[model samples]
Target: MNYSLFAKVFVAVIVIQSFIILIGGQLNIIRVDRLIQQREYEYDRKDMLVVQDAYNHKLKQIRTNVLSLFFDSTQSESILEKIKRYKGTTKAEDLTLQAEIQQFLQSMAYTDESIRSILFVRNSDEQKFAFVRYFDPSLLPNFESMISLKEDEFVKVYPVDASPTKQVLIFILKVNDPNTVGMKQTVGNLVVSIDTGFLQIEGDPLHADSIIELKNSNGTIRMSGNSFAADISQIDLDARKHDSKDYFVTQVDNTVDDMVFTMLISKKQLKQSLFAMKKNQWMTIVAIVFLNVFIAFYISRALSKRVNTVTRNMRKYTPGEFVNPILIQKQDEFTVLEETYNQLILKLSEFIQKEYVMEIKSKEAELQLLHSQVNPHFLSNMLEILRMQAIKENNLNLSDTIYQLSEIFRWNIRNKETVVTLYEELYYIEYYLKLQQFRFPKLQFRIVLPQNLQNQRIVKFSVQPIVENVFKHAMNKGKETDIHIQVIEAYDSIRVSVKDNGKGMVADDLDLLILKMQKPLADTKDTPSVGLMNVHARLQLIFGEPHGLEVQSQIGEGTKVILHIPKNEVGP
Candidate 1:
């Protein structure tokens, strides 16, 4: 082979032709893939829209069913008859009531599977705690909570339900009087439990390369057709990119229930018709590649020596085994090319080293930050609960511990609200005490509240940490911590006292601590007892002027932390 200008021109032509063929093949394949992906995405979105419409219709049917039972003259007679008869906590039904309900239920009129129970809640002071005309209470265990259902829905995945199918969807409708239109007067409530999972979406079931899911606002999948994403960590719920060349995904949000229906489809399944042509195209590219490669292989031997010299020097980059720039005597393009590549390689090497080390360090820093986010005190309490679970055979205690911990975290991490219900606060306190009793083995606690005063609003996490402070400062390792929580109506306001029976502080120390709590807490780096300071600051922030934590302790008895906020200024 002659190494001349004519030979070089022929080699360049062959190389350029091969490059074009290769680029064409790649671009064609990419275009086809893009088309297939777009088609899949559109189909998934279309299907979700159809399903969303179906779900809407299904909800309407449920609402209609509830309305029909109330509006129909025949059903109305029975519905009113129950109110007249089962006034309060009527567990047993009379023959007439039973016969009427059984006949109505057997008519199989509603959208639900069957009638679990027909509860008519009559309006009265004592009736708030009782349901009137409750029938067939076997299937509906603790159906009383349905009284607090804020909105109507097809509740397919209730947390408290442990049914094997776990598919009991309930529809609760507020009953109004007059049995006519435009009536908002609350006479009673209707509780209807549907057995079947709202089988509204029809046609073929999802195939292997597809999935359907109903996800809540938190991206928690409430119900799914198949066993996918059981351990949610495996799937990225918040990923921005919805589609890829291989698969497609689209979401349809149902505003009524604040839930989303997701449909996913595989690109392979979507391009069933175009797949055959893809095989032929690949075969043609293979043939062209072989021919172009054959001609280029023979024509390109003359240039290989120079190219190899450049690539071989480039390979010496690893392990910092590099040399100075080459001193080529030949006055041609290869010499300029090698020298240019050498400078480029040096700059690229420096860039990679800096970025690689920096990225590794940044990732380590991020992981360390995440690890620190897990509070040590919270972890210790959880570990203690686990220890209780391991030692005791009683599942009830374990359940209570888990429930309390869940409620605490629920209020802590998820709820960013400034105000909360005192009832919820008290519930959290009770659970914390129960767990502490298990840990201390002798810790006894009692909560005494004024009659009907648990509904007042206060700050979030206001009471639990104060009671924890009691256990920390007052109780001894061996002795039981006797803590009493009392809520009483003071002069135009409410006073909450958390009294502990352990070693108490002196007057001087008590005064100092109260003084510290009275002042506003600034966002400082080093602060002792964050729990107390944060709670104190939060109370004062919510309720103004001399309304914060008060500490009173004696030498031997114990300490009492008093929290005073207005009955008028309770919020969020």
Candidate 2:
């Protein structure tokens, strides 16, 4: 009853638990942060790839349009006439022709702001004229490459001016004209430049200070955008590295072997919020630790006091004092235990007194039942008197029935033992069937049992009561009853099943009858099927569980009752 030991154990356990929790919490915070960063990176990669794919598709479209222009010129047999209309007349150049040309150039820009400029290089002038989206007609950058173009070509990435920061990608097409018969002549070249900024994609977890860049086959960056600059060669795939004072770098290779996308992230800007989160979590941990210690101390003291109180009450309690329980006011384990202990003592006393009285009454009731068992002999003796009188009249069938009835009583009266040879029981059943046939002339019965198993023993009255019960219900509407009895010797057990073709019971009533057969001897007192219940209980007593009467019946078909008994446990 020394609760100091319990207090010491509680304190030690709580201290160990607190240390483990602290270590686990720190590790958890680190792991959770890494997972968050990983998820952010995954989302960023998807968004960046979306932008890359869409941008590539747009560039392909622009190339297709330029090729269409070339194809159109080849079909125009009067291409020289159209050119002369624009080039030959000064009023045509100032008004109708120039406006039409400018309108076509503007249409090439479409709604995409990334297409900064469009140009038509005559190859005859070696000078290029361009129409920018916002500015007036100006010379396009990287127009020098237009001189050598014979077929369609995608040019290398071009810088805007001296600075290679804001780059543009260009495609050039070689145009042909069909003005001269039997000859195809080269016409002006068509060139389109796309601004790189339009390829940038921004999404959640992708920082503004993060740069996304794509590199082509020559290791030169084809596209770069956002607040930071990134070198494709400096970044490695599946690796994080510091690139410069302003950025951290990572990159991944695309499906194209030579192309890769790289990102430059500002380290401080990306991790500042995470750092703040770690600080708050650390503060929360400290508070939790204090709360845990206070709770552990309070619980330890309260449990120690409850243990002392229980110990004192138990020591002071005597037999008579069980009337008043050891009471604890708080609704906790100790309170429940004390109340249950007192209630248990009270119930135990009551149960013991009731059981004592019931045992004596049960013994007395059993003796009275044994005395009451004499009633059947009076009926048997009357049948004996009838047989004597039938013998006097020389009526053989009447005498034979009386003789069979006498045999049944003799078998019942003989030792009142639970078992008889299988042959003896079958013989009595045959005699009983004769009496039943005399009673019901149309009823027929069949018995199927192996000759070798006839000498085996079974519960004496088990088969008789089942047949009697069947006959009782089997006479429904006076329809002829056909009874089939199968006594088969199985692998580990013996089965005696009685199946009758008669008006069988509905499910609810059949359930009640099966329930009676299943009950233990002590539970069958109130049920109406005493004879069958007695047989079922005896089989269970002799052969153990699952060795008893089984009932099966349907509303119109028939009823089947199988008596299951262990072969080894029954007869020799």
Candidate 3:
């Protein structure tokens, strides 16, 4: 073996494999980095939603308080009576009334922060002039549009001078009086401020930078607050454009569609961490590339040598030649490959022999065609004519004999199969016996066939020659010759015997007959004596030598031809 070529090719393959793995590792690292960043973005978006949900929850709490006060008829009536009683009181009396109003405000303060500011508003200067002059009306923003002069509830945005630098979210509520239920009369307006800052601060622990901003439909900021910002709108905008972090917006329905609540992540730390992750991932990828290269090189070198040896052996193996021994130097995957290849080589030789056998059979069939002895159509016509003549003479026995002879000639000429059933062989003998009876009706013939013989098959025309031999030789001189055909079924064989009380041969003559059957004699014309040769030849062809015909005789007594046929040869 040329180790040098194998070593050089193996080294080159290893190098190429290592290079491919290194490139693949680099691409994998980039993909992993991007995937991590995407996951972080998704997580941050969920966090922003959580923060916005908390803000909405706090606002819902505030709205609940406002609804309770708006629906409280008794408290509303009290506030209305105070406004009516103190409308035209003196400054000193109004001072006493202011004390009562302060106490009333204190009682309602716990309901919500928005409910503490309440004032009566009237356009009339003379009727309610004294109480109106005590407070700075110019300081309060417009509440006339909000007070339901006809019904009892209206909402208005009133800019407060208390926080004139910014803005206040206020709602105006009126208490209804039974006497003025269907009249256009306004007594006072209830004012309250929605604390946007407290809402954003509710869930600050979950959000990195929590912001809540209420904006009007026109995009003007109505309320803005955060743990860190007087103005959260800019940070909120940044959160929207980059929605890499979580951000969400909701509508505040208390004020017309005028207000929207937004919660957003407004810090850079979360993104900074993700960026640092990419840097660390690049460094990790470098180390991974080196490790993969080392592994790919080692694995490729080991795998290629074994694979190449199996390939060479497979390519060199040829059918119809003895297979070479595969030298397995290592007991691993290589050993399996070598063993499988060896099995394939052995199987190839067997297939070749089977194909060759089929080829020889094809050639032998051609030879049988050239050696045919009789004209089939002539033989058939002769047998049929003989059968008809025998029938006209009232000789049914002779007619059946001719029919049997025709069947024998037909079976032999066709030679459709090498084997026939034992029943078929018996039928052949029946015709031969009928012919013998016609020749000498005084000859008594008895046939005893075992029932088991019907299921068994034997070589074609097996019994014809033995029966023919008895008719020809034994019946030549006897006046009352008896022929007995007995078929006995043994354990693994069927025994067929034909016995005749005629002039039997001596031992020496029997031996000579057996020898002649074993080997062909020179004269074909005199060869049909017992047709023992022909019968023996066919038995050997169908079954084998150990199962051919046997003959026994005693001079001046009888002769018996015993055929031992193997039962296994019948069906299979």
Candidate 4:
């Protein structure tokens, strides 16, 4: 994908942050779920304890009521004497005693609604008196089975089938009579049939969806709160296993009856509660994630903007042209990059400037070479023949003028050196002015060279061009055009001033000419000030700046052009 820096940075941050959020969120969910399980398990344990206490209290009350009716009640002796003597009585007396025992059992059953039935069995003659309230008499165990219980076993419980579809628990207790020696004698057994409903919890369950059960020591369920019975084999009953994904089980031991109170808590309910509790946390995490995304986008966009600015400027760059430096408001790594780039651009500009100057010098040298290709010897011989003929015809002035022109041409072409001593240049200038005087009889000139600077080396043709410009542009018709050339020594350099007493230039024209001279020689080649610009460019290129042409002029007053050159000779 052709992703920009901004997109790449933003996506990288988001992916990393999302990964962290995913891992952290999962860990949080695990921790919260565990805490929910622990809290629910503790609550279920406490509720189970409460149920166990209530069961114990109910059992103890039932036991107290049964014991009082068997031994301490007012009818206890009558019931026992009647049960013991019933075997030897007449048929009529037996019926009367059976009726009396039935009435006593009826009174006990009426006292407690949970009491389904009560029975009194006499041990002496194996006689039985039973009263049934809620059970079928055919479902009772034989008298032999009831009496076979050990005397030391005071009370025992059993699950009895009351009908095909109903079951009840029976509590059997032994009745004892005291003898003269204070020893107790077994009289009979009292059996109480209790409705299984009494084993159920009294109030609503702790959890509406949970299952509560009361199981005997053998793991058989005696009473249950919910009709749907949970499979006991699926769980490790001995270990009291609770850590199940489907259900959280809690078992409380009922010491009073050796039973177990078990509560099955659904894990689905715990998960619902956990979700509700973590709703706010999830919202906060989402908010943080969004905020991080925005921050990532902002940062990436800002960096990209800076980079694009730098790149755009780089694209605009061209050799020998000015490129503006990049501007950045913030101070960071980009600032350093901007500074380095600006520095590099500055260095490049300098290098291009030097190359341009060298190129101009090369072109000028090629022009000079082209001009030099002509045979200088033929021209010299022709000019010498003309001068000799003028001398033979007695025209001395013409002969001298022809000789000066020949010397100037030979000096101009003979040497390829770019620098020449001041004395030779001044001598060449004097010869040129003499020839110009031949054409303009009223022209006047002066050459004042200092003795110490006569041998100072400077660029060739630097002085002659300025003097020639005076004749070409500064001459005033019908008046003497006076020219003055002087060499003055200054600090670390020499100034050759060429003054002309001809019609001078106006301020605007002088400024234009000076401006043209200041440009690169190649740029000013076709301008009217080419000769002046040429001299200025050569001086600056050879001796470096502060050593070029400077002009002062005024209309109708005069014009002076100064050539500045270094005092120390330097090769071009």
Provide the overall lDDT of each model, using Cα atoms, as 2-decimal numbers: 0.61, 0.66, 0.59, 0.75
Tell me the alpha-carbon RMSD of every candidate. Answer: 27.9, 24.7, 34.7, 45.1
Task: Put down candidate 4 lDDT per residue, 117-222, tens digits, no spaces.
Answer: 8877777776667788877332545535644567567666665556534557666677776432543688877877776555443544556456666666322443
CA lDDT of 568 in candidate 2? 48
After best superposition, candidate 1 residue 372: deviation in angstroms? 99
For residue 503, model 4's alpha carbon misses the true position, in angstroms, by 0.9
RMSD of 4: 45.1
Better of 1 and 4 by lDDT: 4
Best by TM-score: 4
Better of 2 and 4 by TM-score: 4
Preferred candidate (lDDT higher): 3 or 4: 4
Off by over 4 Å in 3: 1-374, 382-415, 515-530, 569-572
Q: Which ten residues in a row have the lowest lDDT in candidate 3?
A: 126-135
List residue ranges in candidate 1 displaced over 4 A: 1-33, 71-78, 87-93, 108-143, 149-168, 179-182, 195-200, 203-207, 216-236, 240-247, 266-572
| Residues 85-134 of candidate 3: C-alpha lDDT, one tens digit per residue | 66555688776665666555455554544333434453344122112212
Q: After superposition, how far is residue 98 of candidate 4 from its true place, in Å?
A: 99
Work out the TM-score per prediction. Answer: 0.34, 0.44, 0.33, 0.45
The full ranking of all candidates by TM-score, starting with the best, is 4, 2, 1, 3
TM-score of predicted model 1?
Answer: 0.34
Q: Give the runs in model 4 whose Cα sits over 4 Å from its true position.
A: 1-301, 304-325, 328-333, 522-530, 570-572
Query: Model 3, residue 467: displacement in angstroms?
Result: 1.5
Per-residue lDDT tens digits of candidate 1, residues 471-535? 67777777777899998778866788899888998889887776777655533232212476666
